[model samples]
Target chain A: GAGVSQSPSNKVTEKGKDVELRCDPISGHTALYWYRQSLGQGLEFLIYFQGNSAPDKSGLPSDRFSAERTGGSVSTLTIQRTQQEDSAVYLCASSLPLRDRGRAFFGQGTRLTVV
Target chain B: SQQGEEDPQALSIQEGENATMNCSYKTSINNLQWYRQNSGRGLVHLILIRSNEREKHSGRLRVTLDTSKKSSSLLITASRAADTASYFCATADSNTGNQFYFGTGTSLTVIP
Candidate 1:
């Protein structure tokens, strides 16, 4: 693809419902990351996937938040039993390896609204 | 947790004026990067300053890093209304390892 792509640009769901977000990273990029940004807040680190190695799940806020990257190209973020406080924009970015100075390209992001 | 903190949460300036924003971090870093976001969409990488380098310039953007003080500054010369967006600073700590911690960001609005 020309750039990173995210599905379901906007999602509105009632509380306790499960929601899934998808991200397709730029080709040949080996590093993928997920971030959450609440209204009027900074970007919050969520998870990181690099190549085939085990993902860095340290940033996942809770057990309900989980992500998986298949074929090192596409990724998905799932939230079980969503809460109103989970309403925010979920962003996905990909980089060329995990270099200290590598630039990350971001997707449009999914705005999830838990009602 | 966020490692960088930007000062002046919001700034409103007229076009053609020089706009400067400051960022401070608590730990040593391998590099610091600046990014811009329009509305709440995707982020655009603007500039990056390595810890070894004290200053850098690209086009109308100038970035300075004072590693000793654990702080950095971004100066946008001759700002334009199109520059209206949220500017964020992200820091990567070499010792602590991978990932970048983003700052709270500074929202700049340029009035034409």
Candidate 2:
């Protein structure tokens, strides 16, 4: 079975620019989540989608960060007017609904570098 | 915000030795999961223990959960060089809908 995958495994962008990171979750996964991991830091929750309904967005650092999941599938995270502080590894994960707890599969992640 | 913290930022041991990592969370959780990441790649799920369960074993891996203390431990028996990587424990709070809070992780080096 194909696993969750992300695009642009590595990206380098100048500050003040915008970046879009994409995630393709495994087939049939009803839940998708986006997280950010800074150097030597723990995984920070960004947003989560369960079957097109997002119940949590409080983790987004600021207005510049937003994410959308369409058709209960793929998700995209957009960082508008990116800043140097926004640089980090953006991770995507999916699971087989809440019933299959603690078994979320993750993608390779997009390493965004804001220069 | 992070809810879990792993002790001993790093650990190094011989390939045949046992490796143990501990994690403590601040809130009640439905389940505690352990993940392994090599380099900076996406993490791979290693094991998961529900809050009600006290202990579990898979192959050479052993996971124990103590709800009273809000902590968990992962023990890898007879580890191998390929086990060298970072291990993280994530807690899924029951109040939250499938949102997992992760720890800072422990970097383990298995010297062959």
Which candidate number would show the highest TM-score if scored against the true structure? 1
For B7-35, candidate 2 gives per-residue lDDT tens digits of 87899999999999999998878889999
Off by over 4 Å in 2: A99-102
lDDT (Cα) of model 2: 0.89
C-alpha displacement of A57 in model 1, angstroms?
1.3
Position A42, candidate 2: lDDT = 73
Cα lDDT, model 1, residue B49? 88
Residue B106 error, candidate 1, Å: 0.1
Candidate 2 lDDT by residue in tens digits, A1-115: 3999899899999999999999999999888899999876778889988885654788899999998987888899999999999989999999876555737899999999999
Interface RMSD of 1: 1.1
Which tens-of-lDDT digit does each residue in B37-93 have in candidate 1?
A: 999989999998888999999999999999999999999999999999999999877
Measured with DockQ on alpha carbons, how good is candidate 1?
Answer: 0.75
Quick one: best DockQ, which candidate? 1
TM-score for every candidate vs. truth?
Answer: 0.97, 0.96
Q: Give each candidate's interface RMSD in Å.
A: 1.1, 1.3
DockQ of each: 0.75, 0.74
Each candidate's number of clashing pairs is: 0, 0
Error of 2 at B112 (Å): 1.4
